[model samples]
Target: MSIKKLQIPTYLSALSVMIFIIVLTFFLIVGKSLLIPLFLGGFFAILFTPFSNWMESKKVPKILSSVISLLCMALIVGGLLSFIVGNVASFTSDFDDVTSKINTYAQRIDEWTQSTFKMDYEIRNKANPDYLKRVLKENSSNISDFAMKTVGSLSGLVLIPVFMFFFLLYRHHLTQMMIMIYRDRDPNLVKMRITSLRKVILHYIVGVGKVMIILAILNISAYSALGIKHAIFFGVLGALLNIIPYVGPFFGVLLPVIYSFLTKDSLFYPVAVIVCYQIIQMIEGNFLTPKIVGGNVNLNAFITFLGLLIGGTIWGVAGMILVIPAMAILREIFDLSNTTKPFAYLMGEEKEKTQKNEKPEADNESSE
Candidate 1:
């Protein structure tokens, strides 16, 4: 007689998966302090892989090659960083003007509030013209606090370069480890996924970097023509923020417009800045990004926006920045198996692209 198989209830299995996801999310939120640097290092490690390979092709030692790769990365990063810092220092040299203007605005707001709401004399009297200056001076210590809370604030960050070094050094071994984790599956298939993952990640990072450089140059030129103070600083900063996808460019332009509104005599400068930024953004969205990045990530707009919101909520700006690559990598993983193929579809633009392709085919067939 054939033995009856033990069948699990479908609802139970679904519930188990739900519980697993919740538990996993909790752990991710809690463990981000440790995970953030490691994740960053792993990605940067992937980015530097080609450079390290090139070094190895020249008969360089593996460890030495990794070191050389890190050095190269450091030099490029340092050059850009130094430029930003120099511009920032120049910008801050005019801090008193900006601060004084802001103080004037704040005092006006306070007076308006006092009149509009009819607050007690105590509250009204509390509004000193010098209150803003006093608060800024008193809270000078808060600058350190703010820095300490920044994305790279954690002490674990020091290990990022270390992590990158070891990761690059043992890149092959890590790939092998990933393969071994799925050793039950076809090794070749697993290896293909790994290779694709690395390629997609590297392409995305490099493409984004190239786009940022282009944007920065374009922005600096435009801002200089408009005579925007701190042109270099704002230009580079806005470019840095463009890594966050859609929302970043908005805030990037908003700052300069607000400053111009407050500082400049005529409203023309602020209005011109807005018009110029919108024109640049139009070109960037329509031509530059598509031509450069070429939909390698292949994410859908709805999902991308949702990911930005969820990422920003969870880990702030760093999350927003990292979520794109993270989702792309996850899609690669999901694509590895038949069971997960639906998830891969959910994450990718394959269906949408297919629909578009079919429309033209249908038109041609009807015409024929």
Candidate 2:
């Protein structure tokens, strides 16, 4: 008996995989420079869309409105930068003292371990000191490199705002172009998808913005009450870091903890810092987010954490901050197609009883 031969497209499959890997690597290398600005521009454009629409309603020219919006953003950022610059000396001094205090704490820990555990201090210190020093050196180098690269890139492109201005100026045309490109057969479906995406992105921007503001205020108030040095600096830092989700809160708390440890002999200060962060996080999770973001875009905690992790791994802090909004947008797109609707359901906000109870009008119409 002759066995039937199996025909496999091995070469094609291998070639496909290789091509994908190469493409991915190419994007990863260039994405830092290109994608960051593109994404930031896109997000800002979305955030400003409502204002643009409002301007149009008032009979403002799109170009003028776009310019005004960009100007407003620049002024806001410039004011924040001025605030930071004004307090830079205090922030730097506090940070340096905090670093010294952390080193002292480590030394104390080493002594305690030697006394209690009867460990060899010299051997342990020798084994770990070089490793810690090397790690710190590398981290410092990476930070410096990143700063230089960012500044270099920004200097090279003095025309980004010009690009953004045109992008926003022709924003309506861009949406129309997208619809024209994709809506050959089903205009209604394409329109629905666009509508959903706009809603998701808008809600996310507004919600996250409000949350950050609240966290900033809470941090500032708590640090002021504790009499921590550079309270404004730490508050602003916390607000910026809060954009990074789960890991952000830990880093936000770290600055104050280190400052408290350095400036105060009492351990209560550190404890108070931790308690304040926990309380603020609780308030954010329980009260502020629900009210501001509403229940329209509920995400599962585990998935949210996973998105943060994956995004951070790929694009560092920026990716982590963007992941939820990206996920929301993706979910909306997936929900537009019948084949991918299940995936959307998995990612989307849980439906209320009233929404669930509503019969499908399309189904009823079709039956008639």
Candidate 3:
């Protein structure tokens, strides 16, 4: 065969993949309004499927079973949101006091910087009426824009539960359709793969949820003991942020530390808050996640970071939340195929890479 013939197919394959990715990314960005809820509903449906299954096994009608399952989930979510809102309301009531303290700290920090480094921080003039007016004037449009966006998102929230309900109702049909799509494969193997996919994905998401709850309890107790204001709010926020991997815990700690610094006169409370979060993070990373989640994604630091960046870029916060489990599901699929097993290995931890490479090196040495 001519070199051109081989090169033509290879170039065509690369071009096709590039085009596919570009089209997919465009659709995802444009159709986020439609897609986000659908994705969320699908995930929730996965989580609630067992409950529906149990209800079906008990001779309950499928439609009623799905409704009950959705209602149960809604109640849990509503209770959690209500609790958070209560704490947020309490925090808001003290917002003026927090604002005053923050301004005071900002003034002191501005003075310190000027004295220490001879750098005049322009923000010190922010307290001036003229400066304040200008700032408000400049930000007025932004504030209005933000409020509009918030209203839009709130409207979107109503559709989520509705989507989730129907997803749950029709999940069996969906699953059967998925299996049928793979009819070219051996029926038993396809079934097993589907089963494994469901089990792994469900376990990963549920395990993460369990870990977050435990972290919240730990954070709240520690913050309470240290006498931080809005301990529940900060703790829960920290727990939620822990959903993102490495960078999240730092942010979780940073926010409370800033709040504690501004609210409390004593430096000790802020220090204590930092120490507490660091210790909690150490425990969670070293013990809790391993004991609970355990090798679900098995993605290396490189792959995880890359996934986070890509996911965050594509879908913002929702993308970050969804990407890790999506990667885990992909890893599971890759593992099932001999051709893709190497790609799966690449996604695994450093130790796996080291071991795999060492085996080949050892074999080569033995032959030598």
Name the candidate that leads on TM-score.
1
Expressed as tens digits, the lDDT of each residue in 1-368 for candidate 1 is 99999998999999999999899788878877767778878888999999889889999999999998888877876687676555544443344565556556566667777799965335434545355545544554453344334445657556667788999998889879988998898888878878888999999999998889998998889899999888887888788889998889988898788768667766799899899899888988999888999878989898899999988877777678889999999988888779998998998887667899999999999999
Model 2 alpha-carbon drift over 4 Å, by segment = 1-29, 85-89, 94-152, 155-160, 185-189, 349-368
- Of 1 and 3, the candidate ranking higher by TM-score: 1
Q: Can you rank all candidates by TM-score, best first? A: 1, 3, 2
lDDT of 2 by residue, 288-339 (tens): 8889887546676777888888767666666677778888777777876897
RMSD of each candidate relative to the true structure: 4.2, 7.3, 4.9
For lDDT, the strongest prediction is: 1
Global Cα lDDT for candidate 3: 0.78
TM-score of each: 0.84, 0.76, 0.82
Clashing pairs in 2: none
lDDT string for model 3 (1-368, tens) is 65653455778988997999899889977877666667777778889888889999999999899889888888987777666555654543343455566567668889899999999876655655344434434553353344334223654566677888898887667767877998788877877778788788788888889999999999999999998888888899799889998778888899688767756887798999988988998999899999999877678789889988987787776777777888888888888889798878878776756899999999999999
The TM-score obtained by model 2 is 0.76
- lDDT agreement with native, every candidate: 0.80, 0.72, 0.78
Model 3 shows how many backbone clashes?
0
